[model samples]
Target: MTTLNHYHYKRLQEFCSSVFVKAGVEKEQADIVAASLVQADLRGVDSHGVVRTAIYLKRVEQKMINPKAKIRIEKEDESTALIDGCNHFGAVVGDKALKLAMKKAKANGVGMVGVKNSNHFGTGAFYALRGLKEDLVTIVMSNASQTMPPTGGIKPFIGTNPLAVGIPCGECEPFLLDMATSVVARGKIIVAAQKGEAIPHGWAIDKNGKSTTNAEEALKGSVLPLGGPKGYGISMFIDIFSGVLTGAGFGKYVNNMYENWKAPQNVGHFFITIDVNKFMDIKTFKHRMDLYIRDIKTEPKAEDVEEIFIPGEMESRRSEQRKKNGINLSQNVQRELTNIGMKYGVSLKDALMLNHNTEGKGV
Candidate 1:
């Protein structure tokens, strides 16, 4: 493991941006994609972070993701919109969709946007947090390639669809809830496989529909839902809104980002923004949220529980700590990033030199 200072991590972003640019992506869009990926790492969501650079780059090379994708509004109204991503990188398309939703929310007090034909959009929180900055409540959802099997099913039929919500408070950090409907995100299994580590039982099932701890077998099989039938229902609900409603690929039709190299992922995303002031005085709402958070944190703790945490509180704390101490990347991730940089004639070692003033090292 190596801890990279924020300064060096920023340089990593710049390097990734450069690589995307060389791959025919627009400079601005490339930067957005890079920032989104790096932000995932900064916030301690390493599964959605730079670990994805190689796959994304490969997708671009395979022409599965259009570097110069032209997203357009397919339908629009005062407070709603439907966007066609034109097979663009998910981060770029997601940014555009969220911005448009914020614009509509500002004017109408609420906004809803559905996006189709997008790629993997990293973490859903990245888009929801946009509304938090504007003092609005935001909800984001997206469908992914098939990886999770429905309750009692043998083979994979649906994705580990995710949901993220961001709500601002007066005196505390914004509340963010971002989660996959599966028992564990597929990326966790991929990371485990990369590190040659075994997974926990109940996380996934082998091809024969038996529980397995081997990460590679899990990947080759199917992930379990978060709460059996309940999670499966939730994932299916998300797919309906993000995939079927948005006219994107649904169920088994969504192409796997890792397995399918030649076809577009055709994933879908949904965003909704609500202006707090419209329902209640913004100040009052914030004050109430702070009070609620206080009560929850100060409540009695069960045995071995140090404290209760509001959703997203721990991640906020992790981000602040990481900003100062630097981000830790696994050796496999480091090697992958280094190889990607070399492919683009950019030396990661040289990039690290840009942050010579910072202190950190591999463990």
Candidate 2:
């Protein structure tokens, strides 16, 4: 059976940073990538966390992706810009794009940035939350490798295509929404398969187009869209914004990094940052948001439901708890991490020793 272990989050982040540096990535770029991955883990989005780092480094090692890529903006207006990532690590590209969006918003009330020639940027929420920290409403989205189909068709075509939005709420936790257009991110299926677990019904189908609980089969087949055709449309628009509009590969053309070793995945990203003061003062907006949250929470009671949660509330709670206690890693994932560390002459065991390890309840 797949087992679990808990390790201190800070130490884990340090270990990840060191691994990338050893893999020949510049320290600044490596740290940004490492933080983004660990942030995913801390928020319990393990599918996008350190587990995926090994593949990223492998891509770097093969020269399919450039670790020291020159990220530059090819075009811009007062509040909008288009960036060429030069095929760098997605997290580094995302970091620069989000910060630029925030800077423009602060000066011009709103900012929008389009990115091209990037790799997989861990999670949209990572950038969204960064903007949220500056008290701006943020929207982040990306088009990924196609592993899903549109409404009724069979062959894989559309990507999971994730979207994330974060807004500040005065007294309450910010309302955060981050989701994949697919029923689940494809990485989750990869994780389940690694752990020898079956996926839940309605998540994906076999190659023959039949719904199946088999994770391996699901990987070979297509993951179902989030709300059937509705999600298909959403994903299509995301691809338009992130890929087509940004001059990056779209639809069937976006390279899957794992499958296509010939070149880097020309992924794309879109970000929007809005300064609330553009509409009303920050204090007034926060006060209204506080009341709005109260209205929603007061009327929420259903069978077996103890509390109502905002879209990203659960993840925030998970992050807080994990930060205090520790993050859990399945034995399968832990082994993958250790194996990667060994290649870089780093010891995962020593990384864990920074904080005492403990047996924990497995997910």
Candidate 3:
């Protein structure tokens, strides 16, 4: 069991905020990114969350990502637009893009936005929820660096691209689904390697294209897509739309997290926001969605199955618990946080206490 030191977690957030601000991110924007990353840890999406902070700071220092990149609408139509990310951090650009999409959707019946020259965004669900607040169904996808291999080939050729969807249901929480195309995200492999742990089979193959449980070997190899070839096709489709079509980096042309330093990644993303009222009545859609979820969950399971899970249901519940109880992180994460705090000369434990008291909330 990995135990995260609470003091270290709080300190990490402070350190993340300070670095972001030093990089010229506005205070509010820095806070948002920091919160989003921390939220990922709280929700059990360790890969996307705070774990990437050190890497992000490194990119910022290298000037590969603009600390103060300006965001601009390069093109606009009634319900469509294109955003130039100006090489900014993805969390900032994605939020800006989603805001524009929501605004356009409110004005029109639907909205679609494409962005280019962005950095890596944390989680897709963050943007998806933005659309849901407006009673809109949302879709988001992004292309990433090559980490997964093409079907039948050994070397990496495609990224573990992700697709996310969110549907509003009135008073009920939105039905949200966000996932990586790979059987497991690259971060999991990295984490496993860091911990000297063995990954499961079918999750990765070594450089020789043989399945292996060794995380170190998996790092040298490539991950396989879920459902075999079909998943690879889906990931490729995402690359085409979010990368090639947007004129962003694709395949090996993209920046490798392990190597690239100076050049902007020129990443791309797609977002679609559809007003529920534009289709069937919003209530009708909500009730139908509720029924679908309820029925699927209520159905009988095999003897070994303990329970069924809807994609976001467990996540939402876990988030609630963490929000109230504070998030627990692993020892490695705590060590990283401690390092970050020491670098900044700030005590993480002190910061947590300050934050807790400032919010007038008890733990």
Question: How should the candidates be ordered by lDDT, best one leading?
Answer: 2, 1, 3
Candidate 2 lDDT over 1-363, as tens digits, reads: 112366667778888999999988889888999999989998989999989888988999999889878899999998999999999999999999999999999999999999999999998889988888899999998998889998998778989999999999898988899999999999999999998999999999888899999999999899999999999999999999999999998999889977999978999999999999999999999999989988999885998999988888899999977776677788877898899888888777754532354334222
Q: Any idea what lDDT model 2 has?
A: 0.89
Q: TM-score of every model?
A: 0.96, 0.96, 0.92
Q: lDDT tens string, model 1, 24-101?
A: 889999999998998888788889998899999999998999877679999999999999999999999999999999
The total number of steric clashes, by the backbone 3 Å criterion, in model 1 comes to: 0
lDDT of 3 by residue, 1-363 (tens): 112244334445666787677666788888878877876776778888777877887787788888676799999999999899989888888888888888888789888888888988888888887777777899999998888998889999899999989988745556889889999888899988988999998999999999999999999999999788988998999888888877778887777765677577788898889887877888899898888877877899999998788777788887766555566656787677667667756445554433454232334
User: By the lDDT metric, which is better: model 2 or model 3?
Assistant: 2
- Model 2 spans with C-alpha error above 4 angstroms: 1-4, 353-363
**How accurate locally is residue 246 in candidate 1, as Cα lDDT from 0 to 100?**
97
List where candidate 1 sits over 4 angstroms from the true fold: 1-7, 351-355, 360-363
Range of the 10 consecutive residues with the lowest summed lDDT in candidate 2: 354-363
